[model samples]
Target: MKQPHKLWLRSLLIAAAVSVLTIVLNTLNVFEIFENKTYDLRMANSAKYKLPCDEICLVCVDQESIDWAKENYNWSWPWPREAYARIIDFISAGNPKSLAFDILYTEPSVYGTEDDTALGDAEARSKKVIQTFFISENDYDEPLFPVEQIKENAAILGNITSKKDSDDVIRRARLNYEYNGTVYPALGLAPICLTEESIDYDSIPVLEDGTVLLRFTKSIDDYLPYSAKDIFESYEAWKNGEEGPLSPEDFEDLYVFTAYYAPGLFDICSTPISQVYPGVGIHMTNLDNYLTGTYIKKIPGYVNIIWLVVLALFAALIVALSETCFTRYAAVAIPAGLSGGLVLSIAVPVILFNFGYWILLIAPLSAFIISSLVNIIFSLGAEGKQKRFIRSAFSQCLSKDVVNQIIDDSSSFTLGGKKFEMSAIFTDIQKFSAFSELLSAGELGCFLNFYLTKMSDIIIDEKGTIDKYEGDAIVALVGAPLKMYDHAKHACAAAVKMKKAELELNKDIVNYASNPKPSWMEDELYSAFKILVANNKTIFTRIGINSGEMIAGYFGSEKKKNYTMMGNNVNLASRLEGVNKQYHTNGILISQATRNLLDDDFVVRSLDKVRVVNINTPVQLYEVLDEKSCAKEELIAYASDWEKAMSFFTSRDYQSAKIALSELLKKNPSDGVAEYYIHLLDDYFLKGTYPQEKDNEGVAFNTEDGVFKLLQK
Candidate 1:
């Protein structure tokens, strides 16, 4: 199959896997418990609500109040009903907004009819006083109101049953419950109804199940509290004209909740804010929420489903995009994907919360996390495949550094072309056909393999890309698949090294043929081959280098592919290698384009300017003499005189140019560059008109283009 189709299929599979996992997790409702915990965390992190600290109060029958009452009034457990009657009368004088009793009075007082009469009379004088009742589900199914004597005098009766979650935490409350065809409001609902008598029942916000998510205004510690005995004691003190420890005026205009808070009392319940909270405090907060309309309305089930789908798709999209585009940068993208997904997971819910929408935090967070992991796994697998392919393709020819670059970013090594600036190196065995004629096919193969392996190693050591080998020639590229700023220098360096390696290989061949035969050589006829090598029947190669923008990528038929480079720039490098024969020069030849990018460390001499076959303009070429193979003093002197001769030749000074070349040829008798220049001078001198050396306008010595325009191949 085509590579593009395969990539798309992989991406689709990754998206599908993530989507399925998210759907399965959501279906199982596994994230609900985690979501609840996150809700608690957000609530804990949130700023406390600005509840009216003085608006509502809890008058507790705490142990402190019990002890105070016991010491002063000889009251112990089951105190007389007159004790509650005196406390009620004290608070009633202040005309509080609303008062609710969380304590139950299931039966008449055990003291007597007089004690019952006293408590009932105290209730009659109070305004907006509510008594707690139970909604019994027994066979009778009735509202279990307070005793008949106290019920007739009470202003209102409310159900006090608090609904608990499966976790045993009271997070929500029912607005009302029905018994015997009559709807009884909760202990909190009575105060709201009493305060907003003009509001319609249908106008209030309530769930379809007649419930609401309770909005906790404050912690249990923030609730205002007064002792039961303090109220009665303070009222007595004020009536006697002395300063009171507490007074009825303290309860004026506040919605008060009265309940038992002794440690042994069976009224503490777990809430989101506290593990052990007094039920009276819960009622107090509920009533305050109602009065201020702070009740939270939960989103409907349909909205939750849609939200889950949207979040899942969002997570899947991120995974797919990250996998397809950023596969090369897995090291960077993996962590970024994880962190970005996690941030959005948290931020989305928190943002919605500010707008009064409480989204499921953990479920969406799980979707993001699970999706990211799936994509990262797929990406890692794809990256591993790419690295393996790169190792297979380039490991034999390139250095570890170059190979590592491909491993680090496999996307750069895709099966397609990319245009980038690079340097090309081409090398060919001089007179290869003649050499092949002298050896058997197997001998030729062994020799070629040895020669090619040595030259390829030199190129790779300098970080060049080996494009291919054509019979007796090798083509290589630099600055491709991975960028290298000094590609020209590396190409030039490799060419010089290859020339040196060729000499070493020649020595090794001669040494091998002269000494005892190595164990690897199974042929007894190999001794006969040694005679040809010792006679200086050696191999020579010429190298060419050029630098420019070229196209490098995979090339071949459907069943095969080879990573190679191709362009006009590459052709010029090949031409330069062939141009060496015209001047009898060997070693390395480089175009002016390559020479211009080199540092001063290289020893190079200008050869000539010639237009090769199929190219329009003349190109300046240079011979890169191996300094490591030559005497330093001789190389320096030769380069200096050669530059002077070329300058004189281009300036139309034939005599001076001939003098310089003749002197240079005397010092280095085998200098091809000097021989070629002197031959040019000889040809011009014999033509008698000094060759005119002009353009079509007959201008003298027009060497502005600095090219010789070779007439011979």
Candidate 2:
């Protein structure tokens, strides 16, 4: 392949990996779970406005209808069968589509039932008059009504059961049902209204699962029963024989909810609707809409996938741009993009919903998140790659010793999967996120490659393993490929040496943002931020050292492999580095196990039984206070201090531990990570809730071994 093609292939590979990873992560629900959440203001908006759509047609027995039925029928008893006759008579008079009743005649009405004789007599008479719609719940395609009534009217009874999620919020309505292996349209479903338009029932979509295959056509208002609650209740008054309350025309053309006023005969309960939705009534409305040809929801599937992918790719770009730039700009851009995506995604569907079209919103969001991840990841890789090249080039030029050291640790250079059992050190240039205040990518990369070459060289000299350099942090591991009985000692020594070197380098050339004559300065800064990728202010590392059995091999294919560790110990080491922040310490924080293995003359202080989220029990975090002594002494002292603090902290004597840590710290003023921990505990243990998830830099503890681990860069 041509160079351009190879570059394109590389970009494509990155994109494909991002796509696959997004899907995998989404499957893992990582983004959804860790994603920052925003409040749903749409619910408030929904509550404020009733869905005023002209789609679903209405014929409701509103609150007034309930009142009328109450005033006349002895406070709304189940209507005498004759009242239904009147409703049938009124509806039959008009050539409306389909008359649907949201009521169930599951049992015969009780009239004069003191004795079976009188009850039998009334039942015979009532059944005789309205037998047409005594529609039994059985397999039948045609309406089952009293013979004479059938001659006068044609209808379908509502057969919808509104269901909610586990949260009791009704968001879906069942629009089809099966009986005797044959599909039957639920009386309330819109297709039943097709009877009025004289459309064939087969024209509508039906899923094999006996459900309505949402094939909505036309606007939401085109179907009726769209009355406000106040308007639906008037029909009860018109049902009684004494006097017809509404004009016949009102009753004639209307598709009223022929449901009872009693709460037991439900049409008033709520489901998981957007707002205060009357579940049964809203269902009736939905069915009426289905009947009148005003469908809102569409068939969900692959057509939406294309848009989903596009949007996701777009999201990746937005996020990548954000990460590639300064945090402040990223702050504004990412959240705005995320929020805009969320709102536009949901709002478009809602607007379409109002317009009588239904579109799936959730899946699209899934796509956007996938896209954002892609862009951010790919962009970061681009930044890091440029930095890495600069690193490879400059270290070879800077000092032959550094270059030699890097070559010695060449097995651990790959990014995605490389492993080492050495101590992993994380250092940030402190506010390196500010470098782009006005610098281009090439300029920035040159700036970072400079210091990265030097600091990283010192680490390499100590036999450290280099992991990928993050935008501003160089994560390297020590004690791998070639282990030393005193690996922790070597790592600790190197950390101090590296820090001292960074300080020395910082003096010669101050302002790294300038050009070529100023090239060295730019390279230094670039090596740290863009190329070297330092983490934060003043070049200092948060070192987490856990040691145990770790893989010193390449992971991935021969085509593209990285020397990364993949074992329980490696993760624990990463967690420990992050834990440095909790402890408020700098350089060389080890696990309890690492301390246990070393000799006893040097002094190492106990940090705490720091809690990492993955671990239920806290691991003892220790600081290597004095690297000059035998590794044994520092480990022993650190182990002993933790032994004392753990006993105190476990008993919940947070105060005692706090003071003890303070004392330990006073004896060792160079420690920042540990002091931070003492204060963290003072602020936390005194409170009632558990502390937040561990940002122990990436530390994980092996209780069985009592060690600290730093597995990668």
Candidate 3:
């Protein structure tokens, strides 16, 4: 198959693998516990916008009620069933829609059978009252029902039994419970079942385990609790025809759920809103959800798996397609895909929660993350292998910057050319041929390698690309594969540093005789070294730098290509390296074009304008003396005085120029440029070569075929 098709197939395979893994984990309930926690967090965050259910309220049997009972009626912990009867009668007076007891009365009242009958009688009179029943297990063949006395007198019996998740949080309620073939509605659902005839029971969303996810709209604290003792007291006040703190109108048309709120009752459990939530609040939340049609509907496992597969495939395709493109695109697409997928993974489920649906977040999120990571790892492995190959193949032939550029974008390796304003450096060792002939081939090779390595290191350090080496000359270019705006500055800096390094290398050579010679040293090599030492001469390098528009790219045959620069400016740089011999100036020189691009970081003295061979345009030249930071005071003073002398000579003021040159030579007798100019003035007087009339144009010389030609105007 084609590469694109193969990549697409690979991405599909990765998506499939991730989806299947997540599905298996989902089936095994691996993410169930954590998924439940995320669901709770969504519920809690969503609760901030949900208003509390005003239609449903709690009548709590709190400690105050218990203490009041003890003080008023001398009742202990278990109040008489008659007390509950009185409370029921008081609530029924207001004609509430329904009243459900969260408290379970599965056993007969401890006071007597008549006490149970009294409570049951009050429930019968109320006619809207609902009692609770409990079952330890759901799959029991036979389950014990509530006591006969209470069961027969109550209006309806709801299963108050609820289950907690693994995290011990009650987030779902079993709306219906089956016992020995009889299906009973939950206590929270019993009131809704009796009152709301319009609700389709089958339409209610439920999990496979037959439980409805309860969307808690409010906390237990949101409910204003009505004390049982206070209700009893209100009942007495109504009987005496006097005003009371609470009236029958308070409970009118409201669903009153009564349960224990006292901490000692141990009826609190962990809920999404609070760790210690009243158990009775769960039933109230269930009723609130059902009444408002806001109960959370869990999305089916199949639907979740579909979403997971889609998201995983999306992530996989993003990585695969990006990898198929240039590596630069892959670098951006991978992170964007990972972050975008993660955000979507989280947002989908939370958004669904607002619409009363609970889509599984972990399965889809895990699929996206795992699939993206796997594809990214594979892509990196492939790219890494390709990069290693490229680096190995070209690291020695090209600069590190060029090799890296090719690695990042392989198109750079192709044979192409583009013109850019850049700098080129041509370096040659002075008198290298003479010294090389005196040593063996091995000794010559060692010396050249050492010198080339030191200079090459400085070039690379300054971000210059080594073009090639011709015998003992180094040709390099700056700002090609990687464009730098300060190419001229960097090229000049490399030249300066190379000069400094050469001085250090010469010192090493001068001190070589002091150290013990190697056992393998040849007598001829030692003799040549002694000759150099006797003459007090060290190897010097000449560097020429020029900056202009040059065509830089890979050139040569298709089979064997080389990256180099070619233009008139490149020729000029080579010509300037040889120009150092004309005036016997220092080792470094630059063209006027190059000098224009340089900052004040370097100190250079102006040389005469010269027309190089094969180039008709006369270009002015400057000799680089030393970096300003390291240039000696005498050298700075000499350069300044030399500039004044050149200015006088350029204006045809021969007398002033001769006097200035003489004075400069006296100060620094060994200054070759000053002595050369002094001799030039004497030669000009003898030959009458001086210009007859003053001209704005300076004295121009020609280096025709590597020989200097004196100019006469």
Candidate 4:
């Protein structure tokens, strides 16, 4: 090789060595810095996966279930003891092996205070949750457990927990735990072995190293594994009419394995459902699957690693194909196939074969596999026609990764792109035209470039892909490039950070006369730039976010084109940015789509229904909180009240709407959205088109005649 080539090779070798060292150090740090995660795995199995044996599940005592039991038993209060007793009796009747209760008797009982010892004694014995299993290590390095009364009656499952990873929340429960000189099975295992002859701890299949293959069983045709409530409710509804709850038969043979499924009530939370499961219903589903021979997808560690690498390769291929073929169709089809293949791979083996597995392909894998396939095809000259489509589909909204994901997956690359769900963000510097006139071209270029760079950086940093840069605006996407785990969160983060950066930039410029007093000089410069005009200089930008289905990908004329998204959702996103001004807010306005996807991460206050130029119907609007200190409950209450008032105003229920608005103002004295809508409501109810009647939903109606009229059909 030439000297240059030799030197480059040497440098690459050195870099690789350094990278390896860095990776090793990072892995070690990951172990040391994070919480221990062994128990998390156990919890995960308990929540989602089924044990080898049947009959291990948590019967959810939902409000509906409780209500049904109460009416029949003439009971006024919800009690865990009665349920426990019923479960115990049922288990005894079934004459199956073991029984475990995933509950904790952490506190003393209140039922003991009653005269009838039946209620009190039952409550006390219900603490026999310990009866379900043996306890895990109470002291470190020593496998230890105490055999108590319940342990004698049924195989007690010690619902023990270990520390979690510091950076994440995953606990891997130890299988075949050892305590002192004794080895004990997990409560789940213990119960199964005791109840059925099919499972013998000593005889069960095990790896050469003694570990049984643990896996998830999933099926596409089946919904998320059903909880006890689903079946019980169905049965109950069949017996009780439409407005009914569970019936007596619903409780028959209801061998309940009670545990937490409710957020505040349950002990486990790692299911695909909410971080805090609503009830322990997952346990019941798991038990049902365990008994009936249901399973999901699983990939062993070594093989999973291989798949991960393959997917990465696929992702790389997608990028190449997109650049080469330049067609949207190829990009789209590839990813679709990969995602489908992965789902199928996971479903078929577990659901059909009665084995366990997991769709080992991570989000990135699906993104890469499909994108690579299509992009490869599109890159070919014959298919390069999709190039214009590529630009059109993603130019203004997606990040490079998302673009690459689209390129990698033929499914995402389409000339006439199909509708897919995505989160769109539109940001515009308010009054940019006026701001530009105030400065020379050089000054304006510097000003615009600086703002755009900062905002775009923020967006990219928050995992958003920049779609394009319009004169005074920038549009981007969060879910595309790859459907992110938390696109809304990333979008919200970008909006907040961009606004923050603007304020800091202005602070330094405020004292510099040569800088010509940064036009967006409001307290929150970035957010106030176009909207916060100061001394005829407010060039603040407004941001709006809407997440929903939109026709995305490259679609345009061959000669002149770009990648972009076009649809009602995208339009709504653009409309929302301006909506901040109407609502007199500084940050993002979210749609219902955005709301449904969120859990506890956001604090949003509702704004009035927007009467945009072309849209006839009003949409619910919200102002997302930038700080955690913002009271979520109070904000929700206030916003809900305002929305109620808006409803009254829409229906021309002037009196009711006014009352609601006035009530909201009482809670939040300077609420801007409410105030503006209140004025509009008066005029709308009195003069605009709406029925003058007060009902539960006080609403005023207005008809739009412009661009919005076209959408009515």
Candidate 5:
């Protein structure tokens, strides 16, 4: 398969696996505790924006009320039933719709039968009152019911058993409880069932666990509270036909829930809004939810699974597309895209919660997170493999800097040519065939390896790319794969460094004779080495450098391509390497184009204007001797004299040129350039075959090309 198709298929498989795993875990309720925590967080934040139901109020028998009753009425811990009777009478006078107690009254008051009778008589008088009962699973065969007096006289009875999840958080409310083939409405649900005569209990939304998700719209503090002691005091005053602190308008048409609120009562538990919450608050919150029609409805399990699968696939798509992008920015963009996907996963559920729906958070979040992370790992592994391939393929011919550049932005280094200005260097050993003939093939190979290693090290150090090796020649280019504006200077610098390395290697060869030969050395090879040292003959390299516009990129057939340069400029550099033999000068030669870009750090001398084979343009050549700071004083003086001689020759002053050239040769006896010029002058005077026509530059030459043609003698 193609790479992109394989990548996409792999992404799909990863996403599918993650989704399936998350769904299975969710089905098993593995993330129940964590999912509940996230649900609570959303509830707490969304509750702040909703207004609490004003029709419901809490009549709390808190510590403050108990203290007041003790201080004023001398009431003890279990305040007399007569006190509750008075409060009931007071609230009943206001004509409330219904009143319920979150507290259970399964047993008679400890004060006395008459004491309980008093509360029973008052409850019987108020038909709107609803009494509380308890239904425990541990006692399912035998449940606890309110006393006969309270149960018989009250309007209705409800189960007051508060249910808690495994995490000890009360987020859902049980709507009903069954005991002995009879169903009892929960305390919070009883009032709604009693007030709404035509209510259908089955129509109410419930989870598969047979509970309703409570949307707590208010905190405990948000409910209006009436202290029990205050209500009792106001009841006494009103019985005398005197004005009371409490009025009937306060309870008119309201549903009042009364329960214990003191911390010492041990009726507190953890809820979404508070870690320490009153048990009464849960009933009140459930009542408020039912009354306002804002109870949370859970999204179906199948629907959530669908959402999980969709989210996983979406994340996979993003990763697959990003992996296919062959740009440097993909490195950064992939992470950002994954982060956005994760944020969307959480945001979607929270947004749905605001509209009264509870969407499971952990499953979808897990799918998105796991899928994104796995795909990222896969992409990184693939990229690492590509980088390894690039390093292995190019490390031999390209410098470390250039190889790293290609790795960083491989998009820029593709198949095809790019036209740009670059410098090309061509190097060949002087008389390598004759040198090879003197030694065996194995010996020649060893010598070539050592010499080439030294020269290639210098080129790589200057950030040049070795194009190829032909016998003893090395062709290389600069300012390709990675562009360097100072390519000409780098090329020239490598050439000078290579020449210096050559001198060092020659010294090593000469000194080899002083040391005893190794035991492994063959007799014929040892003899050839001694002969070379006795004659002071060493390996020499001729290099030519030229800088101009050329096409640089991968070239050749698809099966075997190379990163190299082409065009006339590259050819000219090769021809210049051969020109060093005809001029009888130093081994390094550069075209005028390369010389023009070189800085003052290098010292160069002009050779001639010559037309090389196969190139129509006559190019000026310069011999690169050494760096200005390292050039020998005698060689510098010889260059100065040679410059003077070239000036006279170009100006058609043949006699003066001949005299100057001879004097230069006399001072520097090894100066082959000066001797060659002197020989040319002698030929011109004897044969009388020199050109008489003057070109625009005032130089007279015999060739129609208007340039010198010096061939190998």
Candidate 6:
């Protein structure tokens, strides 16, 4: 085979694989939302196409009709069955081709048996009336049909249930429903069966599942329905030989569909064309589609695969046959061309849709996108020498994600700063200086690597950007390079996970102490290590998160600049990590800005209001409880008492808060957070000051705002 043929084969294989995956995802309903929206857009854009154009009309039991009935007949809704009898009489006089009542009379009328008999007589008089049946969820094999008298007198009984897609949008019209081993036509199908249309009932192209892709056109405004009140007036006028808004001529050979449209009485469904669409209008649209023979049908699974492969091969051939100049310009012109072509592929479904067929949207589009990306990758490989040099230079300094991002689009990265809302997390080991003395320099380096690696994995897994690693600390940001709406939530979750991870890492260290030392280790060194392990001396880290607008970019000389964040918001996050020390807490602490972004699923409790050094504005802090460390029951009880104590403290009732904290300490004696607040209360009441601190940055409890101000860092 020629080189072009090989390229085509490769492209075909890639498309086939992606197409199959798309099919699997689609079957699992992963694309249901996107597909429904796409269908709605198509319906809104398509030209208005009417079926039985001159024959079909809707007689809605609108609010006006209901009010008219109440005043004229001296009765409210659930009106006597005789009222429908009169409607039947009026519509029957017009000699319509089919009169479908999209209503169900499943029980005897409240008026009397006489009213039921009267309605039954009228239904019998109209040879074209189609009654509706409801398929109850409790039993699909046996349908809930209209009352026996009405059913026996009707021309045909049809199912009224239109199955909605998973997204609650009705995109398919059920053609028929089977009950007790007998298949019955649907409400929409009933009219087609009764009309003089040229459809072969036995051989229509209905799916084996008895459904057809519902093709909607324009909007309900396109088919202006005649009001039921107007039709009743016309009937009275015709009887009295007087002129009215409606005439018998309007109903000649018409397929009239009557349904209640009074809000709370009629079924309101969501559709592509309209969010709150009337269910009756949907049935009318389905009926119209059937009359015009324009119902959409799905392309078979195998046929979809074939279409994908053919399109992919064609695209690949276009690229492979390109001359050297085309390949040289492929970097710019080819991508632009491919983008335009991908957009144009949308027209395939749109055009084929007119012919009553639907092509899987995601499959072809995925093939186009993936194939283009593959071709670019292959082209890069063809220029391996230069590309490798670029990758090697950037790979060392930047993360793999940032490197790939720059490689893909270098213009996105710039030295100029950009301002955006982001969530920043700052973490620090509780006592890093002590770790240096505990471990030799080499062991400390290895330990730090292990800790950082575990923390980095959690951040990256949450799609957070690792800003930089300060010694014994990790600084990360969410919502950069790629925007995330829930950046704050992600950052907070990452903080919680890091705290949990530290606990697990410490446990691993304790477990590892049992392992034998290296042959080079002397007895004294081994004994010292064993003693450290026996004492359960392990690292504890504190995390803090804050969310606010920040400026992010490189800041340094051109040769040595590093990409990171710098702003008041970023500093607040750093301060929060340090504030954990003041609380004597070794867990995650989040500023109010971050707390506001958290959903109800996170377990957190308000810690305090504090003014960190250099920032006069008071920030509210919350402690995010670890799901593993704290039992749910204990956390709930602790949070209740903790909140009560803080409430008293905030109101300047130090004695009450003291009593509350002391009571809480009885149950939760090991809670450092509670003990820390008690100590503050004791010092303020006795010494007239907080624990010893720098003069300018002295920790002072403010009575006016109930905020603890730290005057020094």
Query: In lDDT terms, which candidate is top?
Result: 5
TM-scores, in order shown?
A: 0.50, 0.38, 0.51, 0.37, 0.53, 0.53
Tens-place lDDT digits, model 4, residues 1-713? 12444433443343334334433433454322111121222224333444333223345554544555566555544363544555444333333333355654432333442322332343244432323333533465433232232233343444343322342232222235555566655443444544455354344334344333333322111222223344444444543555234333433333345553321234433333223232233333334444554423234546544444454444444344433353446445444444454454334323422334442322223333333334334333543546545544454444677666665564544233446677899988765655655565655666677678878888888887888886778988887746666777778777777777777766634434334445654323332333223443644668989888775555332112345666678777877886676556765778777867766666666554545544546667777766444445666565556566766755557788778887887787776666766665565545544322222122333344211111110
Global CA lDDT computed for model 4: 0.49
Report the error of model 6 at residue 386, Å: 10
Error of 2 at 315 (Å): 3.2
The stretch of ten residues in a row with the least summed lDDT in candidate 4 is 704-713
lDDT of 2 by residue, 1-713 (tens): 12444434444455455555545554564433112111112222232333333422444444445556667565444445555544544454443444455454433344432322332333333222111132333336444432332323333333454443332333344555555464445555543444454335464443344344222222222334423223213344445533333444553434444444332233343232322233345555455445555433454545454545555665655555445453456546665665566566556655654544444444455555444433433443465563453244335323556434434553233223234444545565543545644346776676667668887888888877786676657666666666666776666666667656766665443344222344333344444443223323345555567766665554332122355454556656766766655445655677777777666634666655655543444567667755544345554565577568657765667788777667767766665654655655766555633343232233333334433232112
lDDT of each: 0.69, 0.48, 0.76, 0.49, 0.77, 0.71
- In the range 1-713, model 1's lDDT, one tens digit per residue, is 22545655665565556556656776787555446555654544441653644688888887767778889889766677788777787787777877788888876676777887887888888856788897753557656688887788877777887877654677777677777687777887777666765334464557676666666654765778788867767878877877678877887888888888764453767676665577776677666656666665566666665665555555555555545666565445544554565566687776665444576766555555455444444544576675664454345544677568656763343234678788999888876755666677777777777778888998999998888887779999989879888898888888888887888888888888888888887453364357457455777887888998888876431113467777789878877876776666866888888888786758888865767654657788888875434438778777877898888877767789899889988988987767866765786543444323221111122255654444312
lDDT, candidate 6, equals 0.71
lDDT for predicted candidate 1 compared with the true structure: 0.69
lDDT of 6 by residue, 1-713 (tens): 23656665665666566556666766787655455555565565553542334456888887778888788767676778887887788878778888899888876776778888888899889878899999954563566688888889898887898787765578777877778787778888787777755345554456666677777766655565888788777778878999888877777788888888764457667676665577877787777776676677777878876776655554554455442336554445554555465655577876666666777655565555555445544534455643553355345545788667756765554333568689998888876755666777666676777789999999999889899886788989998867788998788778778888877977766665688876865554455456557765777888888999987765432223456776789888987887887787757888898878877657777877889875789999898875433447777777777888888877768889999999998987888988888877886643456443322224666666667787433
Model 3 pairs in collision: none
Candidate ranking (lDDT, best to worst): 5, 3, 6, 1, 4, 2
TM-score between candidate 6 and the true structure: 0.53
Off by over 4 Å in 3: 1-5, 138-145, 166-168, 196-199, 382-713
State the TM-score for model 4: 0.37
Residue-by-residue lDDT tens digits, candidate 5, 425-472: 999888775676566777676676777888998999999999988778
Clashing pairs in 6: 697-711, 697-712
- Candidate 3 is scored at a TM of 0.51
Name the 10 consecutive residues with the lowest summed lDDT in model 6.
Answer: 689-698
